[model samples]
Target: MHHTASSHSGPDHGTPRTVAAHRQAFHDLLAAFARPENTEQLPLLAALGRGLAMDILAPLDLPPFANSQMDGYAVRSADIPDAGAELRITDPIPAGAAPAALETGLAAPIMTGAMIPPGADAVVPIELAEPDVFPVPGKAATVRLPPVLAGTFVRDAGSDVRAGELALAAGTCLGPGQLGLLAALGITVVTVYRKARVLLVTTGDEVVEPGSPLAAGKIYDANGTLLEAAMRQAGLDVLRTGISTDSPDELLLLLRRHSPAVDLIVTTGGVSKGAYEVVRQATAAQEVEFLHVAMQPGGPQGLGRFDGTPFIGFPGNPVSCLISFEMFLRPVLGTLLGSPAPRPAVKARLASPLTSPEGKHQVRRGTLLPDGTVRLEGGAGSHLIHALANSNALVHVPVGTSALVAGEEVEVWTL
Candidate 1:
């Protein structure tokens, strides 16, 4: 057995497709299904990790007015032309309260963030003055300070951002600093793109839910949980449909019922040419096309529209299902959702000799060492879930290379 599904007879289907060709086809399919998510206005505090749907312009200058950056005496720089000059103190200015314009030869006590009084071109910190503290009200008070340059310790109007300037551009991903900037600009609400909603399904007669009594010849379903977690990490809103049995009618019913409510549908297993391939049989008359890509572990792949929603099917193996998602779905989703792409591949020496088929790209689970060497975690079998769990990276052995010796460099994709 080839361990993969044969290409369906259709105009869109091609026999023995290359990995690159399948990836391109998948990208085109995603583009056709890329309906723009509706935007909604959410409170600024509630918009973290969301993608901005529109540009945000500053409504007013940040700070809006000149303010003091330090708790000190506001004075004219010329008044203290020499260090240690004493100036009579006036009323203290608290934050959020206005102060009278400073008279010549006099100083006004000002706290940090207080609006700068008119005609005061400099601030001498309280520690620089003789009293070293705010002066008492209604008492004969004076402050001695060092000579300073004009505009010292002043946060001028629009210093951070000017009014009507671009505060955040459209498609910007909101994080802590971005939210802080919006708050500082006094923006209470923002428009953001809605997250993509996905309907995930896994299919197999031998697959059973975890925590159930173990029956002979039945394996617990791990693909559903694995792909669900992956989808969530990719910023998708996922609805898992548990496991569908080997009944084509049951699977089709589930798909039709949930297809209208989701942006995309993802299914694992049943795409291969095995006798119990329900997904393939269920979508036989639909537009879905099943093909075998030129890659090991995840060669059986399917993509099409079912009930007007985009659908992708993977092989039954847990490792194959994940590899398919990483190779095809992740990059396209990241592009549409404004998230980072998969971790980049790095070159590492092979710690052991390995052999691959002449034409298929082999993806082997492996452990990447700190010394830039990669050791295979499991053999090239699809059912080794324990080996997959023990590995932290995927070592990519490209096509047309049948064998490799130890210490040869290969590209490893970090998990």
Candidate 2:
């Protein structure tokens, strides 16, 4: 491929890039950042979306003891070889209670999850045994049970997981199922990879926080909340600034104050080409480089390190900020840290015709229908945050293809 920009030191500089290339470049920057490896111990619930730092070993055998898998009679499999066999009923064994060894020609009432008595090897469901309802322990003379082979309906010790075995491997993301397994293993605490602490900043003099009286020139600050919510949803810990600044000096000072405490810095707005670009002008001599990527909605982007901390600048429009993070930074975090699981790319039928620019790869917001068709939500405006909020899926129009007719199959990423 022909190089698009002036020669630079690394793979990415102030150059134009396709969607895929730009994402890759950003990913490389983050990978090369000198952030130290860190881990934290959290309670099982709090670690649900965190990556495991160490392999979790089963502290002891799951089930701890051989337990009955059914609510029925526990008997020695050797003693009952025929369907109509009758055995004397002894004391009943409820769950969590230990019982004495089974005597020959005797059956003990056993509940589900009840520890199996010594020498008892099988359990018959209560419904299958003769006189389906269980009789009072030792009150009935005899209870007839069908022939059951050894180990039938029996949960053997360590059947789920053995002691000292790996329950979850390092780098595993603790989802509900994984957490449930840990809970079953009686693990209350877990070592998880610490989430990258991000210092989020919003720029522009025209932006003000919501609830403030709207002057002639100000709009409520949305980029801050939009990006912060998105990052938190992806399992990244967000540290936010309550103030939005348009002054380069103020922005730089804010970065300096928070840089030491954060693993990364992300600013929305002021990266695009403009006379008064706050983030761009502030870091003009720093390591960050602003580029116009070949992607609609988020064409302008920035990436570099600030005082050794990884820094990323995204376009200011709310839609651009959200989409940029989703398409670029979010996926990179998944690859690097293994938290915030990756979004699945699937094919969906388009419900309407759409046009894209010739050289730019475009992402359009849409809602996926139950019938598997994606209906476009709004036109390709980078400032349309409401349309984005209504969308549940993203339709990709790659660089080569400009126009797609209805019913054509296209790649989609579900939110």
Candidate 3:
């Protein structure tokens, strides 16, 4: 059931649903809008930050063959009976070249990463030789080398990953290391889950584009740029449209027009009880459920669908809009996409005393100090967008507790 819009914005208003309840509903709404399981073959570079769709098996042994770990002389350990034993140097092997077998009691100068000769059992560094330099490839030479045990300075085949081994598991979030591994395994193309595409709608008659000159009561449209950056940073493909007017019909037309192409439609503002609540008025007849989540900085929220595309609405105030995305939308999106890794959460001491409204989860913007304390940036007002800009952390004051003393420990999510 949907909540009716009420003018009261304070804690004395109707009982609002808890943040946990809103998050659960939001997850269900996304599942309802889920499309068919799809995968796309992307090049290694393009696959970064995407979830791998299938397990990748190592086609060949990592390193492929035994190779020298340093510039050294490849020798049979038995030949080096002592440091004074001099063995005739046969040939030099450089990287990217096949090495011929080493005759018994002979040494081959092998460069780092060069494959070990077939009959060579160990590598003694050039410094360990009487003449500490490699002989000319065609020269006949003898060098006194220190003794080394078999397998010294050797990278054995399959040391890292054997052929047919599970190199990368399914659903692994591909990053630089993962992509590099795929490239090392000779994989140029990879299958990854497609990123969700979201159409963001910003509303309000007083909101003007940034490039436009501001007049009497108009403010620049920050929710568009702010939420767009947040969503794109979270790995969603963002499609932006012109800011919608306060007219419900105009907003509804925009949503319906864009819903066919995007996986989700997110709107900023017009979901509250304000007289010009375009998002609420437009989707009221449809399946949208406007809500009052038990949270400060963000309370008015709406979620449902517009022509089968998932819909979410946040408050018009810049801080509240962004906090709603962080507290409600971001976590769920990460779980759904396996990307845009979650922010680091840690326990931080409060720098000062503060009281929160009982029964509401308060999200306060703050700067996480190097001393492990969180200093509040500004008061708990939703319009303090500047505070958000200055914050490096989101301090969460959970429901049920009312006040916190200086030095009190609290949970903080580092931005």
Candidate 4:
């Protein structure tokens, strides 16, 4: 393939890349920055989305002691074989109360979760025993026991969680189920990895806020809203979000102002080779390196330090901005943020034919049918916002694909 840019040294051989090459390179760069911070203790209820700092070990044995698994008569396993007979009631045991010692020839009334008293070897459920035969008034829960193993109805201590057992491991993202377990263990708080701070900004002279009046050639600021929403939904604590025109001084000033407070700074638009690309001109003198990737829509990618803060610059086009986040930022941040990254392309049959550039990979928005078929939502233009709105997934056609046919299986990345 013909080279598109000047030579530069990289982890890969010094050669021009198809869009896939640049995307992978960008992903590697983000991955290299994936060093998560040490975990912090959060209230048990609020730890749902954080990664566990270390293995969760049970401080005490679950149940702590043997107890009845059901409402039954605690008796000796050496009792008679049949259970439809009455046994003398010696004592009553309720949950959260200590049990009385079993007498040699008498049974004890027991409820579910009631501790089994000493000298009792088995439990006969109320249903398995005969009704009260004792003529005692207002106090009759005695029952006959059916022959069973010594520990048949007993819930042994630590059955749910053994003392010192590892319940959760480090790097584990806490969920509702995990929180329930920790709560059951009586843990009031837990340690989880800290969240990354992010700053999102959008640029362009033609871009305006959503509720503002649009000029003749201006467009609504879709990137800022879309990206900022996506980042917050992904568990990032966004420090600041703003919009600026194509002014190098303004963009530089904003970056410098917010740099110290954020872990990542993401900007959309103004990174390409165009003359008015303010972000490129302003950040070039700093540590950020701008490169034209081989991918469609999101071809221009930038990485560098914005006032000593890590920055990711994406293409100005709406779709390109979103795709760059999914392909690069989302995956890395998901890992550090302790959230699941969006799923990648699943194989789906093509519903129609399409042509793609020979040297660059194409990511097209499409609607995936239940029958495992995929149809391009709109034409291959990057400006097709309505098409993107209707699409449920993005089809990833690799670099070498020049033409595709109906019924061909392709990779589809769900949005």
> What C-alpha lDDT, on a 0 to 100 scale, does residue 88 get in candidate 1?
93
Candidate 2 local lDDT, 1-415, one digit each (tens): 1122232223334346778887887777777421335778899999989878777889999879999988999999898877458888889999988799999999899999999999899998889878888886557668888889999999999998999998888767789999999988888998887888999999888998899899997899888889999999888789999765788999888999999999889999988667798997777667776777888889888887788787899999998898899899998887766677888788999999999997888999999999999999999999888899899998999987889999999999999
The deviation in Å at residue 402 for candidate 2 is 3.1
Full-model lDDT for every candidate: 0.84, 0.85, 0.86, 0.75
lDDT-better candidate, 2 vs 3: 3
> What does the lDDT read for residue 387 in candidate 1?
93
Whole-structure CA lDDT of model 4: 0.75
* C-alpha lDDT of candidate 2 relative to the true structure: 0.85
Question: What are the TM-scores, per candidate, against the unseen true structure?
Answer: 0.76, 0.87, 0.86, 0.76
* Model 4: CA > 4 A from native: 1-39, 67-86, 89-92, 101-109, 118-154, 292-297, 340-415
TM-score of 4: 0.76
List of clashing residue pairs for candidate 3: none
Clashes of each: 0, 1, 0, 4
Candidate 1 off by > 4 Å: 1-27, 31-37, 82-84, 273-276, 291-299, 323-331, 339-415
RMSD of each: 5.4, 3.6, 3.7, 5.3
- lDDT winner between candidates 1 and 3: 3
lDDT minimum window of 10 residues, candidate 4: 1-10
> Candidate 2 clashing pairs?
269-316
Q: Pick the candidate with the highest lDDT.
A: 3
**Candidate 1 lowest-lDDT run of ten:** 1-10
